[model samples]
Target: MSRTFQRALLGLALLGAITTAAAQQYDYDRQEQWQYPAALAQSPIDIQRGVAIDGDLQEVQSIELRDTVATLRIVDNGHAVEVEAHGPDALIRGRHFELMQFHFHAASEHTIDGESFPLEGHFVFKAQDGRLAVVGVMYVEGEANALAGEVLDALGDASEGEIEREDIAIMLPRDKSYHHYLGSLTTPPLTENVEWYVLDTPVTLSADQIAGFNARYSHNNRKVQPLNDRPLVHFAAH
Candidate 1:
């Protein structure tokens, strides 16, 4: 079979397997036939200006946190803050989605009209309100990434049971342009109503750093959902 045909067949097989697994439960089979609109739910937050997503594209000085809910300390360009993970239990304040352990999705989860890239990172955030906000960042092959190197290095000793503390920066794209839309969690549960923000800018990753992530989560990303009726708000950096 042709390479394209083989890929399509493989994709179909994976879908079938996923469908079978999701069917053994009582929940509706959302994974089998899911779709996302080309846009997002109309929210009060201006899809254009949700927050200031700009700064010198520098790595955070350090990161420190425990796995209990995993409050990650992310510093970027000298700005430091703690990112607490509530697991699937912590409430997302206004929404019903709960926190799922944050992991990296090299290349990216969603693509631009079916175009996949080298790497994407996903910060899965679920809200009790049955809503989810996934922060997606794409990565392009380039210079050595200090921040990514640190995190990847820590993953070596990142204990399973409890969250561990590590100091490293979360580097981001210089142009904070992002695309916001409504979609579903790329992973299991495949729940809908997910508010997705695809940063227009992609970060850099060394060949070695990319290999390190692949060591653990080799292609652990869900295929892009169909943009059904969802609207996507593409924003530019200020």
Candidate 2:
């Protein structure tokens, strides 16, 4: 074999290796092994009610769903089912952040007092200045949710597609009470400075609906991280 041909083969091999590495799936079971920022504000932290400070109703942030109907493009990004849409601006501690996209994680990410839920939905919003705020809604086993069913049906047998959804407001719990804290994205890079508002009240979803999602991406939740002395505040709706 010619020396030039051997070098070409070696270059192709290196390129293939790089591509494979880039496309590697996130290993949730081994997330502790993943590289993250040195910051102490990592997320999916267990919100301990005993340690949480009670705040006034005025302190509660408001999420205004301006558009009841949203055109959402859903995709199963191998890690989680992510939906791309905009609107539903959130007022968090006097700052405004607009919704960018939302995603799902099975077996809730942020636990409450060491208890886990069936599912957790993350509504990610970004400010004009590039800051991020996330609203997490927990789903418990109960009556089936219509919106959840629509999303599940749209995502059926396909990895990526778009679907229009009405009544996006139904996604949020009636009670606006929430646990507020500062944290980073649960996924790697794990960038800090994110504002998290995890709803205190959980919504309901039937067992079969939750099972439908699990059948696709089972066990996508990240283990709850340490609170690390951060002040977690519980804001009451009324």
The digit string of per-residue lDDT tens for model 2 on 1-238 reads 9999999999999999987664443777777677776658899899999998987555535555556467888888878988888655666666777888888999899999899998999999898999998999999999889888878888899998777655666777878788999999988778899989999999898899999989887788988888899999888776
Q: Write the per-residue lDDT of candidate 1 for residues 1-238, one digit (tens) a residue.
A: 8999999999999999887655442122333444434223322122333333342335321112223323443321111111334533322212344445345654455566456666676656555454567656778788978766756554464432223553222455556467666665554444556676667777788989887766655544454443545465555545
Clashing pairs in 2: none
Global lDDT of each model? 0.51, 0.84
Q: Candidate 1: global Cα-lDDT?
A: 0.51
Q: State every prediction's TM-score relative to the real structure.
A: 0.55, 0.89
> Model 2: how large is the Cα RMSD against the reference?
2.6
* Number of the top-ranking candidate, with lDDT as the measure: 2
lDDT of 2 at 52: 89
Query: Judged by TM-score, which candidate is best?
Result: 2
